[model samples]
Target: MKLAIVGGGSTYTPELIDGFARHRSALPLEELVLVDPDPRRLELVGGMARRMLAHAGHPVTLTTTSDVRAGVDGADAVLLQLRVGGQDARSADETWPHEAHCIGQETTGPGGLAKALRTVPVALSIADVVREHARPGAWIVDFTNPVGIVTRALLEAGHRAVGLCNVAIGFQRRFAAALGVPADDVLLGHVGLNHLTWERSAVVGGVDQLPGLLSERLGELAEEVELPAPLLAQLAAVPSYYLRYYYAHDEVLAEQLAAPTRADAVRAIERELLDLYADPRTVTKPEALERRGGAFYSEAAVELLVQMSSSAGSPLDSPAGRPRVVNLRNDGALPFLPDDHVVEVPAVFHDGRFVARDVEEVPVEAQGLVAAVAAYERLALEAAVHGGRERVLSAMRSHPLVLQHERAEKLTDLLLAENARFLPWAR
Candidate 1:
């Protein structure tokens, strides 16, 4: 199959390629295209893929290009891994709002809004390419930040797209390990937007296993909470950050971590992980390029696709020939969402069609939280398009953080100042 990776010059390229290597036989990839604006990065990733394949005695026709049309033309699947501003751009998004509003947001909130504004146009531009060049029924896998907003835009623009993030999938493994069960034996189910999902239920040996254990570990988990969100949500296997207001307002997290603030607990965990990654013997370098002789590689979606297609474990019975997938457009893909929310969920592929499983709807409370943030997202998009400060302020008011209209206005003022570079078109 002809597979294309846009933004192939990403830092995570090697890891993604390695993931693909694990299922190389299943994929039997004949052509791999790496497309990026930056020549150096494109060569780096494309070269890496070539070398890895050569070493493994796989004769794959790997190509690199800056032309989006050339890269995506006739492709079976296109994996979008774009970062419009790169690290410097992301810094502007994060630091601008934090500096202006004194709110440290890396992902969601004002920081995310600034990022969405800069990124949405670029994402749309790529979508335009898909419309022009991609073969019929080609899948577009989006692995970008502000996933919900981006996927929503793609759907609205009448394109086929799915937002993807490994956080939930990774957490599933962690939770399973914590419960002393094999990951495969754990029947994990999650529902919600990216980075924000409620772990619905988990089963071990066909028996419910999470509730009893989580009830006991609640106190300890609260003491050293690494993931963001509220303790109650944590108990229910939900992203802790969903209850961000409680953490800041009710001091629920503080009381839960009476000995140390939740922030403090996070610091300790960060330090430990950093220390491990920083260890001299850890070889933190990207050795795949050196040992394998290339600059870039494939990613998780590619590797997983191969496995599912090959029936290595259990043949994906879905129509698309992929084992697990994340999709946005509701053609009965997800039954629970409002038919508009871009949800990430497990999917199966078969008969050249990606089929979304029956995903349960998020709880009413979580839906309200998602709606609150979604309202801000809508306002942000409107503000960006219209350049209206009042509209931006109104959008900020949609967030729970801006409890009052006055605070929301003040927050908008701060955002305007901080995001000036990004808001030349906005008023």
Candidate 2:
């Protein structure tokens, strides 16, 4: 199989390469292509990837190119992990929101909407190139930010696509460790849109262990997710760390006001990672990469590709005891949201397609927030595809975190001014 990674110059690429090398049996590849515009980064990251593949004795032919059309041609699957304006734009996304008293996060609130506006057109254009060149039935696995919005844009444009995020698998692995079992043995009731989700249950050996865990380790789990323990006990579900933007907005804003932006931290980490990648002796994935975040992304990406890109005659089944989490169309997965809305939930590959596993239950308390965010996501997507200042304001206004019209209006202006270089519409 030939697999291509768009934005392959990212410092995150080595982690993915390491996963592919380590899990060759699950999704063996004959060719691996790295597509990116930054020649310097492509060289550094590509060298590290080739070294890791060689160390694993994997015979995959690694190719790096700036030509999207040439790089993706004949590929079996394309993974999108690009950042449109890099961390500078992300820093702006994280910084401008505070002026309006909103949380400064790249994938939530006004900042998330800003990212969507800057990212969507580029992603769709890349998908167009992939559609024209990649093998028929090739899957586009989006690891892009504002994943639910980006994945929805791809699917709505009629691409065979699914959005992948590490949050669910991250929770699964953590829960498994807590339970003293293999990661594959833990299944989480992970549901909601990407970056806006809750862990309703963690099942092991056919039993839901969430109640016991919440009873015994509520504080630990709550601390990990950054929400209050009492809140977790009240909801009886663990919310993703992103939820801290909503459930505890004031505290997060206060911290953001005082602390350096996450984008700043990532920029420093990327520099360190590139330095390591440039070293000829650095044949192994470096430890510094761990602090770069996206924990467990490579495993999640590998498992998704194995199932989604399986040949018709040998479709892979869901892992032994774990359910995959993906961003897919709601399609009645949650009756309250439109069928076209994208959702992140536990899913299984079935009958030549990925199907979201039935949610035996959803946290009732989360419905209003989910539905509101779903509404904002739709407008956000529309603004992304068709540019207009009013449309941008509408999306900002719709977000749960920026509901007040005056604040939304102010944020829209800040977003456009900060991202003018990336957004043709804003320019």
Candidate 3:
């Protein structure tokens, strides 16, 4: 299969190369294309990717190009991992929201809104190219931030797309290690929108082990969620770490205020990674990339792609129906949310598409929060597609973190001002 990575210059690309090297038997990649606009980073990352593949004796042809159409042409699948404005823009996204006392995060609150506005247009443009030039019925695998909004945009635009996030896989690995099982044996009852999700149960051998995990491994679970153990016990669900920003907004904001922005830290790591990638002798992904975040991203991407490509007759098919957590249209997977809205839920790939598994009724405790965030995501999508200050402000106002009209108004202005260089519509 021919696979194209649209943002191949990213520091994270080497990790993906490593995954493909290790899982070559499953995917059997023939050609790998790395497409990016930045020639320098593209050359550096592409060089390292080729070396990593060779080191593992995976004989896939590696190529790089600055042209998106040329890179995606006739490819079997296209992966979207582009950051439209790079880390400098992300620095703004992580720093400016603090002025409004909201969480200074890249994927939630006003910051997420800012990223959506900047990213959706670029994502759509790439999708347009893929539609015109890619192999017929090729899938678009999105690994972008604000995935729920971006995936919603893609599905609404009539593209075959599925969003992937590492959070679910991260949880799965942690649970598997803690329970002495393989990662694939640990199934998560992961639900909600991307970045706004919770693990209600960890199932093994067709049985839910969450209750025992909570009771016996409370401290470790709490540390993973970054919240008090009592809080998790009270809810009876383990929330994704991002939820800490909502459940303890004030505390997270105070901590964010005291520390350098995550963007700053990542920028430093990227510099180190780029330096490493530039080394011709370096043939494997560096350990420092682990601290750079997006942990287990390659595994998540490869597993999803392999599942999608696996046919009913293939050995990869799940006889007992093992589901993978992904962001796709609700389609009644979440009854409370609109069918057209995107949700992160456990889904199985069947007949060349992902079908979201039916979920039990959302717990009463989590329903309100999920509903509220889904509503905000809807408004955010609208604002992202059709740019206007009013739509942006309305979306911000709908966010659980910036519910007050005054705060939303201030944040809207701040976001537009900070991101004007990246968002042409804002300018």
Give the candidates in order of lDDT, highest first: 2, 3, 1
lDDT digits (tens) for residues 143-243 of candidate 1:
77677777777777878776776654554566677788766555556666655666666667667665765676655444433443355544475444434
Model 3 residue 259 lDDT? Answer: 92
Candidate 2: stretches off by over 4 Å: 311-322
Instruction: Name the candidate, 1 or 3, with the larger lDDT value.
Output: 3
What TM-score does candidate 1 reach? 0.76
lDDT of each: 0.61, 0.90, 0.90
- Give each model's clash number: 24, 0, 0
Report RMSD for candidate 3: 1.5
Backbone clash pairs for candidate 3 read none
Candidate RMSDs in order: 6.6, 1.5, 1.5
Tens-digit lDDT track for model 3 on 39-131?
Answer: 999989999999999999999999999999999999989999978788888889889988888888888988899899999999999999999
RMSD of 2: 1.5
TM-score-superior candidate, 1 or 3: 3
